[model samples]
Target: MPDADRPQELPARLLTDPEMINACRLRDFARVFRLVKTKAGIYPSMIARRCELTPSRVGEVIAGRRHLLHMDVIERIADGLRIPGHMLGLARRSWETPQALVVTEREAQQPSEPEETPSSLPGPDVDSILAVATRTSLSPATLEAFRSSIEDYWRRDNQHGGEPLRPAIVGQLRHVVELLKEDRPPSIQHGLYGIAAELARLTGWTYFDARQYNQARAYFTEALHLAKEIDDRQFMANVLACMSLQATYQDKPADSLALVTAAQDQARSAIGTTPRVLSMLSMREAFAHATLGSQARTHEAIKEAHRQFERIGQDDPDPAWVSYFDEPKLIVDTGIAHGRLGEAATAEPLIADALRREDHSNQRGRAFHAFWLARTQLDQGKLDQACHTATQALQPASAVASERVSGHLKEFYDQLAPHRQEPVALAFEARLREALPLVSGSTRP
Candidate 1:
């Protein structure tokens, strides 16, 4: 029998590095934590960064004082450290079921208490309102106001990206938290919790797009906790799907696929499974497969996504959160999936068509899609066309505060390294250096 004190040994298959086979096998979160610090030459800050936990929290976990057993947290660590699930006394992760296990209705009831209260975070001023909220009945109109504010912020985020609007959203989140503490009817409380989760998720996604990943992860974790507290399965699935997208952007395709699978499972358990939402999750799976270089799997996921999308009827109860995933999103994402697998010829026209239809107001998204077009051009060895597409991409990229766009530009610069002697390539390289800010190591692709 394996010693209870001993962590299951680290295997060579974990990270696919033969040289790392004999590395630290400590399975305890704390032991693994300390081992990560000691194995600086191998993993460095990969754990803290990829898992979206602060260094201090990782330290606390290593010291055996922090709560590290939550399902989401465990999955984060398992993916980040490339630890096989079996080693952690969990089931195997794969492309099929991935990391999904059904979260039963009984297990998803509202919590008796809030998950974690804010102790040190700065928030909106609500001292006056808090007293009134406790004594008086919560008004439905007031709840409606909060919902409207959140919806407005969502629109703003979609148009402007997250950097410029995060502060306002955070302010709204603080106000909602204050309201949540007020004495109110159970129905009012439920609405408050749902809005709070929505605000938290918005904050997280903005930070994510801005490439402030640790902060983003922290917010997403809070949103997940709130979603669980209220048993809001739809929002739970949405948050998980967003997390999967983040994993994809970070190039952790295996983890991305797992998270998407979990999102799909969560959606299946929701009171009403909307096809729009299911299609979004399936598209995420397709993207993950593409990133992993699985052409067949990518195609399979894409087909499934399309099939679900076709099932959506005119009167389907589509939520506000998923209203953004339309035919345009599908087409663009299909192109992206193919592009990630290096199928430039098959990807370019679809991406180009989507780019033409993309909203002009969404400068960040337009720039992002343009970058993908440039990538496809480069992949096809059309260096001149790539340079031109990249130049057009830089127009909006320069106007945005997103570190992610800058990262893409940086990657494009790397592609130009070989042709630096060519005047067009040299000029674009110089232009990019002057246009975009240098991304920090944490946000670099």
Candidate 2:
């Protein structure tokens, strides 16, 4: 929550500017703070005063010695800088924007029509590409370079967070989209669209990880369009599946189930898609069913997913994107689906196994799995263990720039609410508060 008693007036040079928004979204505080001082004529101490952070800490962060990792810090920065909550992964800040300038997630909850296309969303102006005397030729090497960059950023997202890499992903997507305007060999044109689609999907997924649903949807819609333009049915199915995953988290279980079912149909119609891809889509169906509290349907979907997964082979012509859906990922997601349905006994061991094998550098992943383990423990009445496990997760949760991880921790805190009077629970709450202090009351802005 933002501070309600803060000043009602917003600074004229807040993140309403695209570049500043990109910098903040990328978590480049050093450059951003420096830009504020040099370009906006705002000093560091003044920034500290405005954002409610210590001047020394602000300096450290600006100097690259500290980070803005916690939600409390992010929320404070949003409130102080008059940054829109949509950009910062917080609830809407108490500030007014020009109606012509933005339509927030809250305001745009219901899509205007049954199908919202990319053209329907406000985004980077594709028609405003910088005019050039000549265009560069699209080549296999260039496409491979773009693919390598996307892969590198994907790895970084798994290790660091989606927020820090979001701007880079968006930049890459824009660059690829721009490249499509150049005249290219007929064979290479489709490949360019494929790369653009993948970049768009990556950008959307990064936004999703940050819990910025509207931005995510815009990119996903763009990706879907690009994929369809190339007639790349497999990629189309994958994008639809990602959209379904987004709907699931947004608490629209029926929408999720419908999207996954549509994805399955697309996958079945595609010529070259492997069983691995189908398996991933089926697993998503299990998630939707679990969300809907349909025990029979959930198990049926899970078993179907397993059967499809078993059919996948080493020589299968699966896309690189679906490669992430290995045995370990399946186990983790299956556990999560079961956990959602309150089957703690079924979920606990699988989650623990996945956590044990998880990469230590993947701070976000570990926090996510650990939170699931804690949830299962709490569900099973193992309060002490759940508290301890949640405490262990808190450090990584604080370090990662993921709203999903933050949301999980908040849920853990609420789970312990009933036991607040207990000594262990009190101690746990103290630790959580240290990591993520829930500021009371609202600022005026």
Candidate 3:
């Protein structure tokens, strides 16, 4: 028989991995197959061929449609995937490598540079919210309830990603619109408009994160209109900033720049705007400039953002949404901007530092930043290290359902395709395959 036709041995590290050991112990064939398929580049057909099973049967096992409980079949899987029998609670196979030799070989291949360093790393129920919105009054108390709910939504979006909350957000937004049509005092009327704008913007954000660009744009436009109706420049600036971010993602750097400029103009004209708000706008501008390949402008914008950030005072009334743009966000955004300009060396440390400083509960944010960090590492030719960094991203990414984070992971995987055969790449691929179901099924708006 041709040596190449035989089932290949998996790297020692992969077989020794706690996750792999646990899956094998639990007899989770689906996970086992996925790991083998991903790590070994052994497709379903290859697994079937090696195990003397049908391809459909192997597919069923990987998809959790079938379980291999029979000892014969289990032994076949062990041989087919080259898992050490002891790991699966079976007697050691005749073909198992000698322990001393395995240890020697593992040490020979182990990298001197360790896996990527660690980075470190909320809101509301919907029922009571609807009950309050159902009340037909434009009372200040009602306004405050909606306002508090909006803040909660923003916090939820921060920690959990916005995809799951879109339905409740839309319902609340519609209720706010209905209240807007009723007669009320001038102050209350403006307040209602503000609330409506906030809801519309939150609705847009959920769509944005889901990559539903058209819907996001429409909601953003609605938010802008509501803000305009009350002449609320600050809120209008916030909406425009959101739109600018969408434009950046869409690759329309010029449009992003234009929108951010408009946002800045609004901020300058508005009374009581905080330095943090300006700082956030500047960071957005830096992103646009970076995308445009305008190095000078990007640097200038980033510098200004830092300057504005340093001026933040306790008395300043920063809107709750912009409050998320703190030191870590600022640092990560700067790193991302440099990454866009292909300066991975300059970007890596900032991103890594941001990760360490970032709030652990902001899982979605961590996922996004972690992806950027991995990309920068990849750009710098640190393929193995990059894969390690990316692996760290998966833990947080899994906790929240977010297409934005999923898309980032997808983009990184696509970029890593060229080096697919590398052992570290193979290992990361296996882990990614295990996560594909969750990443691919991220909730959409």
- Could you tell me the C-alpha RMSD of candidate 2 in Å? 16.0
- The parts of candidate 2 lying over 4 Å away from their true place are 1-96, 99-135, 437-445
Better model by TM-score: candidate 1 vs candidate 2: 2
lDDT of each candidate versus the true structure: 0.74, 0.78, 0.83
TM of each candidate vs. truth? 0.69, 0.70, 0.69
lDDT of 1 by residue, 17-57 (tens): 43333332223566566554555332435567767788777
Candidates ranked by lDDT:
3, 2, 1
Leading candidate by lDDT: 3
Candidate 2 lDDT over residue span 14-81, tens digit each: 55677777886665677777867776676889789888889999999888998664334565676676
- Candidate 3: residue 223 lDDT (0-100): 81
lDDT of 1 at 81: 62
Candidate 2 lDDT for residue 397: 80
